[model samples]
Target: MTFRARLVGAALAGTLAAGASALAGASAASAQAEPCVQRIAVVNNAAFVMSFSVQASNGLETANTDTYPINQSRTIDLTTTALPVSADVRPVVDAVAGATRTPSSFVSYCENGQTATYSVTGTTYDYSVTLIG
Candidate 1:
């Protein structure tokens, strides 16, 4: 089922730790620190199928092998196979295989239990990743 994105999540204490911890804004000393263990909604509104993959500062990568159809949204569970860091959802496959799109969301944007929505819109030649909550 497609998970709905909400407006909750992410808190950093003091200075962020190094590496992936910094991206996640998590530190052992920070009492409000929380991992980004939540559902992510990938909404594809483009003209062709879209493939996505996630990369974290902690050297963790999850490649979504399935192609998402246009006008469809896929709910991905990051609670188990991922960390708390802000991640990059790269559009790896589409009509334009060599085109580039940079759209990212901070870990602090959504709470642990909340969902984050990353929508891809437009055609392959002029695609953009919508940074929505």
Candidate 2:
């Protein structure tokens, strides 16, 4: 090939290689920076209402206290919240007339793209919550 044509070809090849390298670097960085998504579902099997609160390790908190009816489930999305590696889930049941029942068991370590289910079940005035999955 002519010298001028060869030089231009080499320059174009170098530019393409540099661009490809930069694109690969950017893709790697973005993959590492992507946040995890957690899907949490709370099931109430008791006779009364139940409430729940979820807090991420990064101090992001989400709660649902709208009186979850019996035999129903509520799902919360924690993808937008800044969760570090785990999260804290607190559940309370309104089993009694003027009292609240707080479950001793809670959920931790919510994984990415996984669904965690918390089920609350018991007789009236004696409710319990446990992580089923």
Candidate 3:
């Protein structure tokens, strides 16, 4: 699992927060800060398999001495590990001025086997969750 990519969960939370703010305006702050509301959708671009040494061959063996690869996939369900990455509704509210709203959602794209986080600030919350393929 791309734990680094999981960081995107925070960014994802931020986007969701921004969207809530846009719809609720002043009330978005009161809303519970959460990342992956229920079943967050991630476009299954590809699946990447990471090999971990569940058990070492011997005491001298390292946990991740061996390496493996799995295809990367999009359209991931975050409900199972539904945990808030981060929370920051204040900054989002502060940024929102008149018609110009910061970012209400994340427009993520994968490049070079990594999901590129776009330009979005304040609203993005950072969280972590377990992913199973």
Candidate 4:
């Protein structure tokens, strides 16, 4: 081969190798950018059966809402491409005999692991809610 041809071939090979390396690096970075998963548990410590809804917002237009029964604990799994900074829990009070209570509401922020637990307390006349990591 001519010397000029050899030089051109070498330049093309080097360019191709550099491009492949860059693509491989980008793929690795994308693999490392896994979506985050958040776990939330709700427990009811009240006498009457409680119903509650959980909602998670993560900048995206989509929001997750689900209602679950209390007394028995419920675990909610929230998966999002971006981390969820906040969540809201709203309770619905059921009519109980001789009971006058208001539903409790809670707002919680994400922790390092994005795990939280909320509990419903108080009697039929009054309801209290708390959230903790």
Residue-level error in angstroms, candidate 1, position 124: 1.2
lDDT of each: 0.56, 0.63, 0.28, 0.51
**Could you tell me the lDDT of residue 80 within candidate 4?**
40
Error of 2 at 95 (Å): 5.2
TM value for model 4: 0.40
Q: Candidate 1, 35: how far from true, in Å? A: 11
For candidate 2, write residues 7-119 as lDDT tens digits.
99999999999999999998855543122236667798877766666654345666554666788888766664454454554444454453565545545544667666778
TM-score of each: 0.56, 0.52, 0.18, 0.40
Error of 2 at 86 (Å): 3.2
Best by TM-score: 1
User: Which of the numbered candidates is closest to the native, going by highest lDDT?
Assistant: 2
Give the per-residue lDDT of model 1 (tens digit) for 22-53.
Answer: 66554543433122436666688888777775
Candidate 2 Cα deviation (angstroms), residue 121: 1.1
Sort the predicted structures by lDDT, highest score first.
2, 1, 4, 3
lDDT for residue 16 in candidate 3, whole number 0-100: 99
All models, RMSD in angstroms? 15.7, 8.6, 23.9, 10.4
Give candidate 4 misplaced runs (Cα > 4 Å): 1-37, 56-71, 80-114
Better of 1 and 4 by lDDT: 1
lDDT of 3 at 64: 26
